[model samples]
Target: LFSQVPLVEIDGIELTQTRAILSYLAAKYNLHGKDLKETFRIDMYADGTLDLMLMVALAVFKTPEEKEKSLALMVKKDKTQNFPIFEKILKEHGEDFLVGNKFSWADIQLLEAILMVEELDASVLSDFPLLKEFKTRINNIPTIKKFLHPGSHRKPPPDSHHVEYRF
Candidate 1:
């Protein structure tokens, strides 16, 4: 019933909202969580990661001068704020994944968010050693590794042409 750019259709059903689509896929793939509490934790982490992702998304639409400023601000906030929380979680949880010591949507979201920031600043995770390790660990997963291989479906960072197209 919904119509939008991110619409996803499967099994004769269509999901238009980003969250709805992600939730559906997460649930179907068994990445949501094992219980309510775990689901809440996964949602919390995924939402936080989305905040970072949004910043990167907005940066791409800015002029060169503004883009640099936006990216710098994004990196500053990520280093001083967002990255620390995730680093702490990895430290205290003593787990490879962010929630329940199992691979979940949260891990996938965080890895994607981290990579987006790294596109602007290669050393974005330098201060967060745990996050670096986490990225490496997640990147090595066979499925993810295959998806990340060159010529995969991954979209490159947005360029000036994207900004023009959006306007």
Candidate 2:
């Protein structure tokens, strides 16, 4: 509803995914990194986080047998393996935000990652203090803080319309 509503207009330039939308906005508004190469690196990390969250969401509502299988695989590859890779990038780029010191599309991607897993299991973040801190930091930002709370336009859609991955 948000994208096609009274105040929201859908542009003809079609981007297929959330990450693409973020990237397009960032580049258009100069919220991307210092240059093209840095922008690509930032996007790569953001996309990786998106992929990980998608896997976790799949595991959350699967049937018992399927859930168990998905959980085992994700715990190994998604959390244990893939998470640390992002962690290292965040640490290496340890300026308050990902991809240079300015807030960029990467921050939005990371916020989505945290939100995706937070409802499933808070403990999923226990191993990554930086990730936890990153979420808190982003949410506290004046602009982002508005959306983090209820009643904001960016609040998640009602449950009925949201994607539920029951198996």
Candidate 3:
């Protein structure tokens, strides 16, 4: 059933768990990295991206005032905690990609998270030079460039329909 998701059957198998689906695709596309060590690093970055996404997700359910507060917190955590971690990794690795010096799942995850935050606050990346460069680099990639264009399938930022102020 895929939990009401549109029919998605890969290799005749139905994957319900989020990580399982991502893992399968990453493995199939050779985005899991070269070896276990690389995979570990990629997974760490992927998890970090998920954490960033969760912060934004939490803000979607709050009232306007609460949403503002939550988003401020999200930006603060991102600027002070999340972005610095990735900045350090990119600076130290000195590579085009986050791990193994090659494009992988980690790079994709980070780029997606970066864009999502940028949508909320355009200046979210102002102080993160490497990440800013990283975004430009990733955005220039042929496939990603096309995918990011208007009229593409990329989901837009959360809107009124997606927000709910629960008691």
Candidate 4:
């Protein structure tokens, strides 16, 4: 299985940016959102998830000690600020998924975000009931469950390849 997964190519047009690719597929599959307002809301949450991912990505390639310290700070900001925003969104929406209650791209992104943070700290999500439930709910979806089964595709580690990386 290819690492750096989720690379989508359609009609010879290749997309590499994760959010853009996911959003494109979501739009194609009618999972983006039901309306314009909801689309913007989905974008906000999806971007939040992207920010979480970036925090981890930026830390990669650093010295181990530096990575550890930087990740710790990122976790602090996440737990204190970023996470509460989504938690409140879920609390306010009172729905199974984020945004307009439908299973949108943002829900998928949130599950990715949860998995990314859990990489930093296994118990990081313990305090966030909504996020924890959201992760479990997304995982239980039949198609998603199969996709997530062990030995499936995985995102490539940033430093695993020599690509002249930089922040």
Off by over 4 Å in 1: 1-3
Q: In candidate 3, what are the lDDT values of residues 1-167, reduced to their tens digit?
A: 54543234788877666677788889998998788999998998899888878778667666889988878877788889999999999999788889988898888889999888887789999898999999999889999999989999997766677544222
**Between candidates 1 and 4, the TM-score winner:** 1
**TM-score for each prediction?**
0.91, 0.71, 0.87, 0.84
Q: Rate the local accuracy (lDDT) of all candidates.
A: 0.88, 0.69, 0.84, 0.79
Name the lDDT value of residue 92 in candidate 1.
98
lDDT of 2 at 167: 16
Best by TM-score: 1
Best-first order by TM-score: 1, 3, 4, 2
Question: What would the TM-score be for candidate 4 when compared with the true structure?
Answer: 0.84
How far residue 75's Cα lies from its native spot in candidate 1, in Å, is 1.0
Question: Of the candidates numbered 3 and 4, which has the greater lDDT value?
Answer: 3
Among the numbered candidates, top lDDT falls to 1
RMSD of 4: 4.0
Q: Candidate 3: where is the Cα deviation over 4 Å?
A: 1-13, 163-167
The segments of candidate 4 whose C-alpha lies over 4 angstroms from its true place after superposition are 1-7, 160-167
RMSD of 2: 5.0
lDDT of 2 by residue, 1-167 (tens): 23421132247544545555666677876778898887887788778777766676555455668866765665556458766776787799687887777788778877877676565556777898787788888889887887767877764422323335221
